[model samples]
Target chain A: MNPRTSMMQGNIAVAEGAIAAGCRFFAGYPITPSTEIAEHLARSLPLLGGRFMQMEDEIAAMGAVIGASLGGMKSMTATSGPGFSLKQENIGYASITETPVVIVNVMRGGPSTGIPTLPSQGDVMQARWGTHGDHPIIVLTPAGVREAFDMTVQAFNFSERFRVPVILLLDEIIGHVHEKVTLPDPEDLVVIDRKKPTVPPEEYLPFEIDETMVPAMANFGEGYRYHVTGLVHDQTGFPTMDEVKIEMMLNRLHGKLDKYADEIIQVEETGTEDAEIGIICYGSSARSARQAMRELRDEGIPVGMLRIKTMWPFPTDRIRAFADRVSHLVVPELNLGQIAHEVEHASCDRAEVVRVNRITGDPIHPEEIVQKIKECR
Target chain B: MDYQKYLRNENFPHIWCSGCGAGIALKAILRAIDDLGIEQDDVAMVSGIGCSSRTTGYVDFNTIHTTHGRPLTFATGLKMARPDMTVLVVTGDGDATAIGGNHLIHAARRNIDMTVILYNNNIYGMTGGQASPTTPLGDIGTTAPFGAVENTFDISGLVIAAGAAYVARCTAFHAKLLDDLIRKGIEKKGFSLIEVMAPCPTAYGKLNKKGSGAKMILDQKDAAVRIAKAEKMTAEELEEKIVIGVLVDRDIPEYIQSCDAAVAQAMNARNGSA
Candidate 1:
């Protein structure tokens, strides 16, 4: 067999990426812009001796992914806006129970199934705060088909390492766009598996932590015979209402991600050195921002672009430094200034922040971003 | 059977109130597992939110207490991924028939290889006497102060119609029968459902003027009749009685087997085309 560049859609790349990352289980419902992911996996996974199930709904999909993760398989699910909303509760369940899984939310216009075929980055904040409570989350946004493939593999790596659900946020345009790309060989990719317990079955505690605050997980039917619950629990994984135990549990759950922020956060920057204007964006908007910056730079304007790959664990410190150096920041998003507020808060009044937002089921055009950069400069 | 060996002794005295039938159901489940000689490591005990769901915590297995009405879905995933292991689900009436009704019907329809033990106490015991989908008509609860007007569900019958391979109904009062039914359900290769009619002395009993736990259990013993005997009775004669025993038991192609076969065929077809 000879290798050649194959034309592939972003969603197909994601499914291939998951399979390369050793994802053995996928359960999801059909939703617009994300349905191709399920379709591809449904055809591909079974051939690789992996399981693919189209669950009854998005909630069940999330639940099944969590269960499959507990069964010692890397598992994933995909859906769109309304389905993403339905999955929040189980997402929270996975967070509290510390189950490793991946969720792909192909962004579409919404508040309730607004536009199925159109592109919008409206779920950025919902991806962070959609699930109730103060649990830790990791979300990644990809700007192109290749990044969708690369970041999906990264999402699984992060989920396995941190034992948290990693969200791969893709907009409708990126998800549906066809691009020619060389798929990476599986042998060259870095894959991480969850750490298993070293102790004997009689001595194992499912929630017992070491210095890392992450307990080694034992798969079901592995003789550990441990209990896992959504309730706040102690090192033993049983339900606990004790104030001290609850506080300790919450602190560890939040602290593990916070401690590894340096390893978890990824940001791509261009021309930020000695620039007068910095355009900060992610997802599909980042494509426009990059184009706008290139055009403005050609006109002898000091415009820079910072594209965020890891959306949550927000990269506040990097943004703060960029804010301090630049005179103004331009944030272009599909929604009405959702992540712009995060940029403003991270800037801490050091730079003037300009919000360029659109919600008309359309992608932000490079011209609009260029206009914002020129006006802000 | 040495049922105590299956329990997490330090986690006791359990949170169940005096005269609660959850303890009885738990004991029966443990006894059934012990009788069947199933290894603890091979059993994945799953449950949803409720008083009955808390049984996962006390049992020494690979237990998972999930969100309300969602254990079967989770169990389905686990079983699909690890078909060699036995997955069992424990749910309450409200957890199974109210919020999780869709999952129940679909799980049965798929005939997935898992056993579901639905603890039907007729009221939301943990939430303090609210009416559930299994609450009988004219039964009083906190949400049904003027007496419940809604009809109750026939859980076993519904699963039987939904294509479960094994379906049975037994009460907490009939401990041996319940144990035997659970064992039979667990041994089945496809979806098996055993609806355990437990009593909630603090909730259902108090609200419905059923005296104490003992009195309610006595009521169950009096009202219960074998399916064979009940078949001979007319609708009017059987109106007040509860049918107990296996309602359905049949040989069927299990879901996991079908899924594996389908995958094999698809792979073969892809290879052929390639």
Candidate 2:
């Protein structure tokens, strides 16, 4: 029989996607536009033989997810802007310790609790640099309800494969929108389980990096006892102040993503084969850009759209290549020039980068993006 | 018993001061785990930032030394994920009650199965000396230069009120009793808190003129009253006394067990509907 189709809300779709991805543990404190995700998970996870817990606060939620991940479960937590801000410290810890967990941040207007119920992509840069220090992060932004489902599953896969925290950046628009989704079969989806240590318990070192720079993980009760901490550490996972070891560890952390950028970074392009103008967008703004590109193509203007699915590690090489082909790039985002700045830096003075920015608690309309594309032309 | 077998010998001599009670507390915990014959791989020792939080680093087990004031939260997650493993949280007074106070109460309320060994030195021993939530009202510290004007917290009473299945208080001076209680706490199937009123000679002692480390530990032994004896005494009569013993020990549904039951029930319901 064919797969079942149902009308699902974005938040619910994300929850279903997580269940499909084999996420057996979820801990989160509710926040607006993201609360539905938690509610749905709370109801659905148990039915699927999973655990969902409401923690005391956002910090505890993040901490719990990390602990669960270390205990050999695919874990996740959902939050909005304020809660995401509260989670930065533990997020940093997850980064340094190489814990495989997923964080779902449904974006809203915010420096502090700004427009909790409204749609805005204001957390684009915060998703990249909210946590302190030099660390690598994988952030995927989904443009629609279907993409939300697909990317949530991908988030878990990437986190498990790389042994790093993955952030699913969902704007309030995509999180709250309802759409018809055809759920995929679990057997058809590519699910990656964390690599367990092949060495004996006495020989296992938690932070021992193999050729891939990603260490195999052993769960707490799995006979491979080891230490995990936030401090800069050596292969034994003990805290060290040695400069050489610290440098080597830091490089390995960054190298895991840097060397694997080809597999990590993903972007979707349309009509860019022979185009003079290209529109750069992501999240909800990508929808507007796609609409505008279609209208421009119908009008016989060769304008293409490059929608970023993976926001961090920045997709610089692809943007630079696009810059070489297109004469001008018009970037539209909900925030005032966060990713636009990166686009300009990546273009390397090749393509003229013009930003169409918005901070109002509303989606960037296709007409506004069309006007920018025409201006770029 | 050879306690050295459980310790990460290369990581020590530890960062704790010469006369600090955290070492004594750590020794007692190791003894309890050893006495219980729990496997090293089946125990996960979690600690937050403080002098006491360093316990995870020195122990040869599955350990996690987490960020400040967050060990209980992490322990909750670990216990929930692997309910079969014995999870222990080692936190100091400031790490447990001051910054992580909210987590403490919530965890107790949920009655998650974990043993929390709160090393209460009555001051922030790691950061030199600063006033802590459990510090005496008239105690002196660097932060409380003259004297502390704030009231202290009865952490045992607090956790008992918050619905922990097992709550106990002991001191570094009472090593045997502390060890016994820790063993009991570990055996319990819900949240168990053993608040150890440990000494900080380098910090709280020097500032508050509480005598040398040996003398302070002696004072703690003298100041403590058995819970049964304290129950019969008047409030005014027990003013300067610390009540030491099991404050609450009873059976309750554990958090992870309850979650597992919920999962089973939901699955069963779904099956019935199908």
Candidate 3:
């Protein structure tokens, strides 16, 4: 069976999908679980006239992608929890400056390099709050290998299309899992390119606002030159301290993500049409939730699984939609109730939801998730 | 001629005082970038938040004004992604040594192929001149109103100890020499840390009786030692002065060179195995 309609591990498909989407620059520092991504990119990037650099450390590795993206390349860097922690500052800058880049966070046991070789989804909150400030962010989580590939491509597409940093949140299980990946000729893929300014170089403000909210980005040599700062700035991209300007810039930073919520937020629901219990989870937990939901439905418990594709600027509306119908919702994650908070916030006192939290550097068992769903039932 | 064209003219005069070392350092960086014949596009200048970090707007390039003292971090991603491009990291004494000091050592330890021009004014240029990591003991600044009690850090010595492949010291007194060192730092293959000894006459200089900018330059020039004499000088004789010029240059494994080699070997083995 081909990838057209066959099962594939999420990580393999992500690697394949990234290649399919024309990602040419891959720089990473090795960490467990995510190491395969570096290995795969190292092997594949060179074959497609691209480059991969195993940086001295994760910090430099992430920095390399930031520089490469500005160099007019679709650059990506992968790391697990500790490495992701190191990349947070740059990721924040990427958000503030609207730099188009992709970061694949194959989260593992963390807080301080907890477990390098095991699977854990403990970075759910760090993915959104690790970096400082109130800048806008976009995160995409893949439930499986197909999404690993499709999401990597989507992460790149979203980064370019929106001119923001897009994160592909994968867990160690999804990152290291081996499966057959479907790859097609690159020419056939819908490669999303950044919106370059058609305005003349002199007239082009690098971060000048237009109708899209995201400014028209210009290549380095193309001459529409302006400054980009991590500080809150106005339409010109210069650092501004004016209170009004700060508010406007902050609003724009948030608006670019929140205003276009319908276009940006993504999710998949199974058996939700008549389900009494809703299972909410993401990353590798989404996989467990799906399996558990399957087992529960077979037992005729009337349960559904909501797999969140977009993690940050989350599938809030979807959770709200589910709130109108489901009597109870359950969130099982490797961390202490991160997405559960989002679910609770989105549920808005409509549905009774609780968290199943774990931090043992192990995956949530499908049976455990199903049991949680049943308990809610 | 059009310094304004190469600069964000609107943010002119900068946040620097009448005689700030970071501003001069910024000029040297731009001159070096222009001297190398690197296109504005082919070069990127990154800075963390500080008076020196503010230099990102002073030079025209694909610039990123990054968070505090993490310019090296951002530059790392930029250079790794586009190895073909020249990446420069401009930071100040406190930013590189205090807050972002971890990155400074790691970058040096890795000997990554990027030029880090550290503007060492011996005082935090922003937040009203605080005591920096490099602030000599007993030197008074805004924060050290009762005199800096910490031992001064020798930047060149620190970089060498941190495993930087290219380590050099230059002062604002030696602008031409410092500029040349900055250029050489850029041309280097491994991690190059050119610690520029700059003056903050309005802040540290004024309080420490370091004299006006001209006098400060003259003082530095008087005390400056060449590498030959610097090596010859007895430890006791060099207590109060600095030995300027290229202090350290040795071959080390550059980040990309090692990575490229590993990638080649892995691919060859895979092919051979297949």
The candidate that achieves the highest DockQ relative to the unseen native structure: 1
User: What TM-score, computed on C-alpha atoms, does each candidate reach?
Assistant: 0.98, 0.98, 0.89
Candidate 3 C-alpha lDDT tens digits along B1-274: 3455467677776777766677777777777777777777677778887777788876767778877767887777666666777878888889888988778888898888889888888887677778999889999888889998888777778889999889888777777887788888889899998888888887778778888887887777788887878798899989778788888888888987887787778778989999
Candidate 1 pairs with clashing backbones:
none
Rank ordering of all candidates by DockQ, starting from the highest: 1, 2, 3
**In model 1 chain B, where is the ten-residue run with the lowest total lDDT?**
B261-270
lDDT values of the candidates? 0.91, 0.91, 0.79
lDDT of 1 by residue, A1-377 (tens): 33836888999989989998899899999999999999999888887889999888888898898998899989999999999999999999999999999999999997797988999999999999999998899999999888899999999999999888899999998899899888777788898899898989888878776679888999998888889899989988988889998888888899999989999999998899868899899988998888898899899999877888899989899999999999898999999999889999999999999999999998899999888777775
| Candidate 1 vs 3: which has more DockQ | 1
- The C-alpha local distance difference test score for the whole of candidate 2 amounts to 0.91
TM-score between predicted and true chain B, model 2: 0.98
TM-score of chain A of each: 0.98, 0.98, 0.93
lDDT of 1 at A51: 92
User: Which tens-of-lDDT digit does each residue in A1-377 have in candidate 3?
Assistant: 65365556655577667777777888788877777777888778876667777766766676667767776788888888888988887788788888888888888787797877777777878888889877677888877776677778888888998888988888888887756555554666678899888888667777766567887887654455566687878887887889997887777777887668888898888888998988888877877787888788788899877888888887888999998898988888888887888899999988898788788887888988766666665
With candidate 2 superimposed using the best TM-score fit, by how many Å does residue B114's alpha carbon deviate from the native? 0.8
Misplaced by over 4 Å in model 2 are B267-274
Q: Model 1, B169-229: lDDT tens per residue? A: 9988999999999999999999999998888999999998899998888889999999999
lDDT of 2 by residue, A1-377 (tens): 45558787888889988998999889999899899989988988777666789999999999999998888888999999999999999999999999999999999887698988888888888889999998889999998888888999999998998888999999998998888888887789988899888889889878886798999989889888889999999999999999999888988999999888999899999889988898889988898888898899999999887889999979999999999999888999888889989999999989999999888888889999888778765
